[model samples]
Each structure stands twice: as structure tokens, then as C-alpha cells.
Target chain A: MSLDKHAMAELIANDIPRGAYVNLGIGQPTLVADHLPADSGVVLHTENGMLNMGPAATGDQIDPDLMNAGKIPVTELPGSSYFHHADSFAMMRGGHLDVCVLGAFQVSAAGDLANWHTGEPEAIPAVGGAMDLAIGAKSVFVMMTLFAKDGSAKLVEKCSYPLTGVGCVDRVYTDHATFLITPDGVVVRETFGISFDELAARVPVKLLAPAR
Target chain B: MSATICDSAAEAVAGIEDGSTILVGGFGMAGMPVELVDALIEQGAKDLTVVSNNAGNGDTGLAALLAKGRVRKMVCSFPRQSDSWVFDGLYRAGKIELDLVPQGNLAERMRAAGAGIGAFFCPTGAGTSLAEGKEVREIDGRTYVLEYPIRGDVALIGAHVSDRMGNLVYRKTARNFGPVMATAAKLVIAQVSEVVDTGRLDPEAIVTPSIYVDRVVAV
Candidate 1:
């Protein structure tokens, strides 16, 4: 069976190196924080201006002034520090972040990312920090299903949607399997419930099979 | 020169000319200067350009200002949110112009403006529509797009406390753009929960020095 969102998040959380400064994008990526071990030493970076972000705040702990990038109230950990927007993004674009996990609409064989906009004429576009994380993080990971709701492959040879960053994605974790983007091309790292051949057939890009 | 202690929000926000580019500080409602914005609306500054993180939420604060057709353009990174209906309506109806910039660039541009930088080449938006037609050059073997500063005629900021010197301190994430915006504008106005006597607030703890602030209003 394919991995559920929880399982996928856990897999990503377990792979993170200890003491890695990570920024998990909003939505499904935010759940990765849940599976991180208590002593993982992982520092969470919120684009809205926080570091060492803690779990969700409740009751007396909740402060309107302290929230995650997703605008949800969050607590501050022991090493937490607050800065202004410029300093916050400098941590991103200045090569200070070790990893950033993002959600995507499509990822290309060349590791281009497209998630911010669908290119719809009437749709309101909101890019946020997607492009910064895409280009800045030392290693950029993506967590999303292999296919869209229309049953189309999201791992395409070329992105049909507008791109967030060009040649930026490092690893892609999908329900079917985990794929690693390399200078050569996209390669299968491991399979979940699907076979390498079947995954290759389903994805439009000619994926490099894993070395057994 | 020292910052003047204003008696009211309207007084702090006064003298902002029409069609001015204003920097409104906040990451949503967290650090929004609602009192100053309310005053700006009442002060009737139209054809304005607003730079902030999110456009507006619900029907209060910045949204209310936008609803009155006071904004001519919005220079922001993200404008679409669940309750950003006011900005959405104006954008869809072509009542306002939207300059969608990457969040990092949004901050850096303003930082550049305040720092007196000519312009800087950035890697964040390279090879994307946001960098389209802009000057792209290879620096240190990596592609970079030239981005310019985003200055403001006035900056409206919200902080937790302010002393008579106009030195300010903010609370947690509420400090998002306040300190930076304070420097990037010609005039900086801050609305604080309360005011204190000079030298009462520890100078070392002040996030924004009095040099960058023009007015301090206690709401």
C-alpha cells in the first residue's frame, strides 16, 4: 500500500540529520514537525520571523504575537530568537538553512519546482517564500503525491505549470516512492508499494532506476 | 533629532501625502498598526502603494484601507489569503496593480532601500517570471537577477512599548517588518500599547532606535 500523509511525514522527519536547521512549508509539510523526536535538535524556522519554533500553543501559552509561518499560534523553544523580516529571510537566502521541505504541484526531471501558481487567469497568485526556500536551502526536499487529482503525473519532463525555481529540488518524497534528483537526472531512491518499473512507466520523465 | 510623542494615532499618521508609497508593518494581524491605519483612512490618503507581507485579512486593518480604494498598487510577496477578499476584489476588477515579488526579495529590497544600496543581484527569483526581463548575470558561478530597493514615503509600524525618545521594542513575531520598515521610509510612525519616560526602557533592549522613528503614538 502507498504511504499515507502521516507515514510520509514520518519518513521525512526520520531522515533529517540531527541539529539541522529546517523550514517545513505550510500544509502537509508542517506535519513533519510532529514526528521529529524530542531531542532531534532540529531547529524550526518560520518565515514570519522565528527560530527554534515549538509545538502549537494552547490556553495560557498562546500569544497572538508568536505564530508559525502558517499563522498558527506556536510556542517558543529554549533557543528561540526573534528577528525582523529581512534578517529572517537572510537566514534563508544567505545559505544558513540546512534543509527546507516544500509541497509542489509539479517537479521536473531537471529538478525545477512549480508550486506557487497554477497559471489560471482568474486565480490570485501568492508566491510567499517558496522561491526563496527553493533556491536558498542547502538541500531542498519536496513531499507530495506522485499524481495530481486529474490523474496526471506530477513528475514531468517539463513543468506545465509556472515554476517556483529552476533546478532546485534535491529530493522528492511521494506516496509511491522516494526519488532523488541528481545532476544526471531523477533517480529512484526507494519504492514504497510500487515497483521501480511501474513508477517509471507512470511518470513522464525517464527516471534513472535505483542501483541495487 | 528626537521623535515627537504624538497625542493620538491621527496625529502620528498626519502629513502623509496622497499617492504616497507607505510601508505597513505586520505579518497578518500580529504587528499591524490598526490604530494608525484607522487614522490613515480617516486622514484620507488615496492612490497609495502598500508594501507588506499579506495583503489584508477579514475586513479590518489594511483590508479596510484597501476597501476604501485608497491603494493604487500593492508591492507584496503574498496577497492571497482566506480572508483577503478586499484585495482579491480590487485585484480581480483591475482596480489595483499587483507587483508579486518573492518574500526574500520583498524584505531585501526594503533593506536595500533603507541601507542606501543602489541595487543587488539575488538568486532567489532567477529563471522565473518574477525575474523575467530583469538583468541577469553570473556571479560567483551562480545566476543572479538584479533587484532594486523598495522605499516608502512613510512607514506605519506597531510595537509593544515605546519610550519618550521613540526607541521601540516589539513582541515576538509581531516585530516582523516594523524595525526594518522604520528605517526604509522618510517618516516612521509607530503605535504602541503604552509609552514610558525616556531612559526607562533599557537602551540595549531597544529594537528600533529613536533615529529611525519620527513619531510615537500610544493607542
Candidate 2:
């Protein structure tokens, strides 16, 4: 069966290596945090300026001053630390982060990412931490619907919109399939509901089978 | 010399000139110094270029100041948020200009200003629209774009507590830009929840050293 958002998140959660320092991008990519196992030893980093950030705070746990990058009130876990924005970005840019899950508007075959601005004259572009997160993390995993509302593929030969980072994505996790973007080509690691041929047909780019 | 303790927020923000590039600290409304921003609004400085994380949330603080048509430009990371209708309205009407930097660059650029760094190569915006027209270089097999320091004329910040000498400590993530912005500006004005005697604050635990701070007002 085709994966829903939760299934996609669960898949991504299960794949994260143990003790990974992870940053979950805003929106759908954040769902990966919920599916992470309790004893996984993974630490969450929020760009707004906290590490070991806990789940959404409710009731008494909510502190006006403590929030995630999305500006949502959040709880902090034990060993959680606060830092200024410079140090926070330094953690990512210095190659200290292991993995960062991002939501992409489009990811090209060469792994070029375009998720920040759509380039629409009417759209007020906001590029928060996506660019730094893209090139910083050792691995950049993208989460997005495989197709646009107009029924076009999100994975394409080249990104048409304003790019966030160049050749930065490692893997793209979508509802229909999980694809590994490699120097060799776009490899279909696994498909959920559609056949390999159907998936290939839907996407404009050529695809490769898993090397193994 | 230590910072002067102000009796009110308005007194702290006095003498800010028009067309000043002010660094207002906050990520959304968390560490936002609402009182100081209100005072800036009351102080009636116009043609301002503000640098912050977000433009504003709802119709308060920065948004209120923007609504007053005092700000001419916003140099920030993210300006479009769910509650950012005020910035949207003015921006749509061409009333305010925007200079969008990535969040990391927004912080580090100001940090460069504070630390006396001239310019640095960063890999963040390399090969993006933002990097276009900027100088690019290859260092150790990776491409980097040149970025300059972002200094501010005045810094308005928020903190949880401060000592009489203006050694400041902040609560949780509220410390986002306060520490860095404090150093990046000529005059720093901090609005704190409480101010105690100079020796009361543990010097070891102080987030922002008093040397960078110029004025402290207990909000």
C-alpha cells in the first residue's frame, strides 16, 4: 500500500542511525520526531536555539521564552542546552550535526534542493535555516509529497524554483517511495504501492535499481 | 565602565536617530523586548532598517512599529509567518523593503560585526539565488560565498535578569540573539525582568558580559 505521512515518518525514524544528532525541518519533516524510538539515543536540534528539545509543551509545561524554530512553545529534556543563534548555526555548519530532515518543494536528480522560495512574485519568501541545514548535515533527507496538486512530479531533472542548496540532499522520502539521490543517479531504494515501471513513468527522470 | 541603569524603557531608548540600522533581538515573540520596541515607537524614530529573526508576530512589538510606518526596510531571515499580516500588508503595498538572509547567516554576520571580523566565506548560501552576484571561492575542495559583517547602530534586546553592571542572563531559548546582538552594536539597551546588585549575578553564569552592554532597564 502507498504510505501516508505517518508511514513515511515512521520509515525515516527507523532508518536514523543510533546516537544521531538530528534537526527536523519545519512542517512535515517534524513528524519524524514522533516516530523515533525512546531509547534510540537520538538528539533533536531546533535552529531557534535549543538542543534536546522535547515535544510540544502543554498546560503548565509551556514557557513563553522556550520555543522551537517554528516558534511553538516546547519542553526541554534533561541535558538540554540553550545557545545563541551564531553557536546554534555553528553546530550545523561545523559538521557537528549527523542528520537533518528537510521538506523540499523540489529535489533534482543531482540532489539540488529548492524548498525555500517558489520564486512567485506574489509569495513572500522566507528562507529560515534551510540553506545552512542543507549543506551542514552529513546527510540531508527530504520529505515531501511526490507530486504537486496539479499532478506533476516533485522530483525532476533540474529544479525550476529558487534553490536552497546545491547537490545537498542524500535521500528523499515521499509518500509513494523512498529514493536515494546518488552521484550515479536517482536510485529507487523501495517503492510503497506502485511498481518500479509505474514509478519511473510518473517521474520524468530516469531511475536506477538499488545497487545491492 | 559599567552600564547606566535606566528607570524606564523609554529612557533607555532615548537619542536613537532616524534611519538607524537597529538590531532587535528575538525569534518570533519569545525574546522580543516589547517594552523597548514600544518605547522606540513612542520615541518616534523613523526610516529605520531593522535586523531580526522574524519581522514580527501578530500586531505587537515589531509589527506595531512597522505598522506606524517608521521602518523603511527589514533585514531578517524569516518575515512571512502565519501571524505576519502587518508586514505582509506593508510589503505588498511597497511600503517596506526586505533583505532576506538565511537564519544562520543572519546570526553569524552580526557575530562577525561583534568579534571584529571583516568578511568570511560561508557555505550556507553557495549556489543559490542569494549567492548570485556575490564573490565565490573554492577552499579545500568546497565552494564558499563571501559574506560581510552586519553591524548595528543600536541594539534593543530582552533578557530574564541583569546585574547592576549589565551582566545579563536569559531564560531558555530567549537568549537567541541577545548575546550576539549585544556585541554587534554601538549602544546596547537591554530590558530585563529584574536587575540585582552587581555582585549578585554569578560571573561564571553570565551569558552576555557587561562590557558589551551600555544600558539596562528593568521591565
Candidate 3:
């Protein structure tokens, strides 16, 4: 069956192994938290300062003390514990995370990542913790739009935007297609309904399809 | 008629002046003191120094101040890179000075000030460039780093609800900076969505007591 971005995200989340620690990047990637399997035991790690956090609360039934790095109020599972901020980043940069799902402005076929800044002289230069997660996670997954608003492919041979992490991204999930980066080239995992070559043509680099 | 607080945004922010240093309570996007921020934006106060964990995104939070060229300095740890028009403009124009504090130290510094603890030391930034020029003290054959107190002239905070007597409760992430900075500021103004009767809130739920708050406004 053909899967759109939402469906693809849900499918990928369903496959996450039980008890795996995962970090959800901002934007569309943040939406995956809504689809975690009820019967599973996956734990969500928020960069702000939450672990084993539940989904957002509906009303006044909120705890102000529990929030993500973004200051968004979040729920705490029974086992959740709060610690020093550096300890949280230590877990991230020390290679303790199992997987990380991040949103990307651009990803290279060679597994490079560039999602932090746009290099606009008039833009804020806050890198936050992207560089830490991209290099620290055991495996990296990128979620983004298949193409930019200007009709250029965000999945390219090399990123033009400043790089966040070099040759680190392993899986690519997008609105129109999903692929895996390989030593040979960009290998098609599942294009869902879109044509592989059609999306590849938009990319600035050479494309090589995986052997079926 | 019983006494009432300012009835308009203008009156709400009339006390704020140019070149004032303010501490705001919020993690990043959560529990931001929206009403007071809106009032400040509307009041158009300029050349302000803001201390917070994150610079609110463009058109929101502290970012709104940057958008208006009202901010003269920023003391924060995180500011998103995706959108940058407001913050970048202020930085590039040399109108803003940035002080990047480690998250824990920032929170602790405010807490220490609020608690009237003049200064404290920790090993958080020790052996790193973050420790540059800071006093280093050793005790019991161990090294500890010294960090100074950072208090604000005023603290602008958001609460889920507050009582008539000024006890405060914050929702989830909104609780991050509010309670700590409440006591640290000379004047604390809480902007809440609802105002309740005294003793209406659970004793355990009160994050900031009436003593720390000078004023409360229903958003």
C-alpha cells in the first residue's frame, strides 16, 4: 500500500523495538510521539529534560514542573526521573541513545546532515543540540519534506546548508518518499506511491537504485 | 467598587522602562508569560536586557522584543536556528549582548538569588572553556567552580492560575523558570489565565507563595 508522510512515520514507529530510547526531533518528527504503540515499552527522551514522558495533557490536569527542553508541558510515566541538564546531554553525547529521529533541512546521499542553520546573516546562530545528537546516537533517522518550497530536492548528493553532522544519517523518511543511504549510492527502500526516478531527478547528485 | 489592577495592556506595562533588566520564567515554548510579553510589545519599551532559558521564537515570547528592536541584551542557553530574522537582526546590529549559561547553572543561579544565597560553586563547567576567568575554589582536596548570583529588577512569569492572595501554580513545562525566578526578582508580576480565591489551591500545588509575588494579572 502507498504510504504518505504520516502513514510512513506511523509505520516506522511501529517497527521500533520495545524498550528502545528514542529522541524525536522537532517539527513533523515531533508528531510521531502521538502514534507510539500502546502495548509496547518504548521510552521517549526529550532534550529539554524529560524521560519516559507521556503525551500532552488535555486540561488543568497538568504538572508545571514537568516540561520538555522547549518548555512545552509534558506527562511523566511512572519511572520518569529528573536530573541535571548536563547528565541528560551526557547520555546523548556519550552514545547511550539507541536511535534518534530528527527533522532535516537537507541530507546528502553520502549520509551527511545539515539541519541546523540556513547561514542567513540575519538569522540567529543557535545550534542547540543537533550536532551532539547527530553524532552521538547509535543510528540516525531523518524526517523531512521530500522537496523544498522552491521545488528543489532536500535529499541531495551534498548539502548546501551548513552541515550539522557529517556522514551520520542512516535512514531518510520524507513526505513523498523514503530511502536508505548506501556506499553505492542512494538505495530505494520504499517510494510508496511516488516514482523513484522522479524524486531522484530532482536531486542534484547521481542516483543508483538498489538491486531488487 | 473594590480596588482593581490595570484594566488595559497599557496600564499593565506602564511601569516598564527603557534599559531595564528583566528575568522571565519559561523553559522555551512552554508557560511563557504571554500576556505581559504582549503588553510589553504593545508598550514598545526598548533597550531592555532579558534573561531566560530560550529566546522565544519570532513573533512570540522574547523574540517579539527582538522583532521590535526593544532588547539590548540576552542571557539564554538556546535559540532555535530555523527562524532567525528577529534575533539575528539584534545581534548583528550590536544592540544585543549574549551570555550563554549552562542550563543547570542558569536555573541554579536564579534559584540561589531567590533564596538569598549570594553565591555557590559547582563542578558543572569545570575544566571547560565555560569556566574562563571565574573564581575556582578547592575544598576537601576537590575543586569546585564559583558562579555568581544573577538577580533581576523584575520577573515576568506565567502561571496556570493564581489566587487573590498571589499564590501561584504553573502548568507542566510552564513551571520551569517561574517559581525559581519569582523570589529572585525585586518585583514579580504573574500573568495568569485564571484567578481563584485564597485557599482554593491545593497547598502542595502552590509553586510560588504570596510572599514572592508582588502583583498578579488575569490574562
Clashes per prediction?
0, 0, 4
Tens-digit per-residue lDDT, B1-219, candidate 3: 111334554565667878887988766556678778878888877788898877766577678767777887888766544454577666777777888666556766787787788788764444334567999888675455798888898888877888888888776445666777787888788888888888799988776888888778887
Ranking by TM-score: 2, 1, 3
Candidate 2, B1-219: lDDT as tens digits: 899999999899999999999999999988999999999999999999999999999998999999999999999989999999999999999999999999999999999999999999999999999999999999999999999999999999999999999999999999999999999999999999999998998888999999999999998
Q: For residues B1-219, could you state the per-residue lDDT of candidate 1 as single tens digits?
A: 989999999899888999899999998899999999999999998999999988999999999999999999999888999899999999999998999989889889999999999999999889888888999999988999999999999999999999998999999999998988998999999999999999899878999999999999999
Displacement of the residue A62 alpha carbon in candidate 1, Å: 2.0
DockQ of 2: 0.92
Task: Spell out the clash pairs found in candidate 1.
Answer: none
State in Å the error of residue B55, model 1. Answer: 1.0
lDDT by residue (A131-206, candidate 2, tens digit) is 9999999999999999999999999999999999999999999989899998899999999888999999999999
lDDT of each: 0.93, 0.95, 0.73
Write down the lDDT that model 1 would get. 0.93
Question: Residue B164 of candidate 1: its Cα lDDT?
Answer: 92
Q: What docking grade does candidate 2 earn?
A: high
Superposed model 1: Cα runs more than 4 Å off: none
Docking class of predicted structure 3: incorrect
